[model samples]
Target: MNKKTVKDFFDNLAKDWDSFEQPDSAVIEKILDYADIQIGCSVLDIACGTGILFPYYLKRNPLSITAVDLSEKMCAQAEKKCTDKRIKIICADILDTHTVTDKAERCLVFNAFPHLGNAKDAVQALCRHLVPGGILTVAHSESRESINNRHKEKAFSVSEPLPSASDLADIFSEYLEIIHVFEDESVYIVSGRM
Candidate 1:
């Protein structure tokens, strides 16, 4: 799908996005656990609609967080969800590198991978913001196979298939080291260190 179509789809869903697509807390916990975020580290949550992962990140008591999303209404909702003064939310496209800053301790892409037009570009943008030795995680509330099947069923244009754990490792080979790949009952987590 083109950027406009993707933007409209999400914009239309912004109001009920969270309730309509509630993530499994178990899956969320597992992904965050694998992240192993440390205190005082700056983290970025990409495509962070409604900031579902914000609460989990807050538990780690990070020094700060930067959340970005393409939909303005979604960002508004996330702003309400995230009350911490340290959190800064940006309403912008993930593919726009100009909107992202550099060298975060961790960067997270959760439940929003397939929606991206260029997964490689998105990954590269995140990498640009990750400190040397920083971590990056990509997770979903369902298994890769399940997520793929659901997208097919919905007739959503998946420009690129979500990468497998091994695929991700290869993609980030130059900039990161694969740390772990976890596939639980309802989620898949791919963690890497920069």
Candidate 2:
């Protein structure tokens, strides 16, 4: 799908995006565990729709959080939800090298990877901003089949199907040391250390 089309699609739904999905706290805990977010470290929240995970990230007391999204309305929604001084919301594509100038200790792409134009290239770009030994996690609170089926039903031609856990692990392995891979009825996660 065209990048502009995807951005517009999400912009239309940004105001109500938080209501569309309720992420399970337990699963978020697991994902964060794999992320290994350290105290006082920098974080990059990619595709941070409505800042749904901002509260969770705040719990770790990170030094800074740079949240990026392609949709301006989505970024505005995130800004409304997260008023913390440590969080900086940017209305720009994280895949663009110039958009994020600083490296981060932890990077997360949560519940939004399939919409990327090129998943492999996106991962590579995210890895470039990851500090040595930092972790990057791509996760979905729902199962792969559930996410894919919903996209298929919606007929959003922009949405790409999520790969199997093992397949994603292999993809992440190209840029990071594979740390975790888990996919079950409830959730999908693939995390690696940079």
Candidate 3:
């Protein structure tokens, strides 16, 4: 699917997106644990649809957060959910390094990696946003198989099947140091550091 298809599909689902799709809170906690983020963390939340991770990130006492999405409606919803002075929302394709500056100590792509048009380029771009030792994570609350099945739904015209954890780790290794790769019935995560 093209960029327009992705935007339109997510836009149509933006308004009650949470009720239709909710990530488990445990997974959010797991991501935080893996990253070992502390106060003064600067974050870049890629594909931050509806700001689902906003509250969690806020609780970390981050210095700042840059939330980005391709769907305008999704960004609008996220804007409504997060009113923190540190959080900034932008609606733009992740592939296009839009007007936002890229300087974050932690870049997290929660449940939004597969939709990227090119995994390799996406990893490379995400790496550019990080500080020298910053972490980048592509994580999902559900198993890879479960997520693939969900993307098979009628609304998904621009989604790609998720690569196995090892494949993802290799992709990330091209630009960053592979830290951890975990995939099981409960969650999938590929984390690396620049």
TM-scores, all candidates, are 0.91, 0.95, 0.95
**lDDT score at residue 99, model 3, on the 0-100 scale:** 47
lDDT of 2 by residue, 1-194 (tens): 68888899999998788786788999998888777876898999989988989999999899999998999999988888788999998888888778855789899899899888677887898899898998899989889998889998883676788889899899899999998899999888899998
User: Per-model C-alpha lDDT, please?
Assistant: 0.79, 0.87, 0.86
Q: What's the count of clashing pairs in each model shown?
A: 1, 0, 0
Report the C-alpha displacement of residue 26, candidate 1, in angstroms: 2.5
Error of 2 at 79 (Å): 0.9
Give every collision pair in model 3.
none
lDDT of 3 at 126: 79
In model 3, what is the error at residue 187, expressed in angstroms? 0.8
What's model 2's lDDT at 183? 93
Give per-residue lDDT, candidate 2, residue 84.
90
Question: Which candidate order results from sorting by lDDT in descending order?
Answer: 2, 3, 1
Residue pairs with colliding backbones in model 1 are 103-129
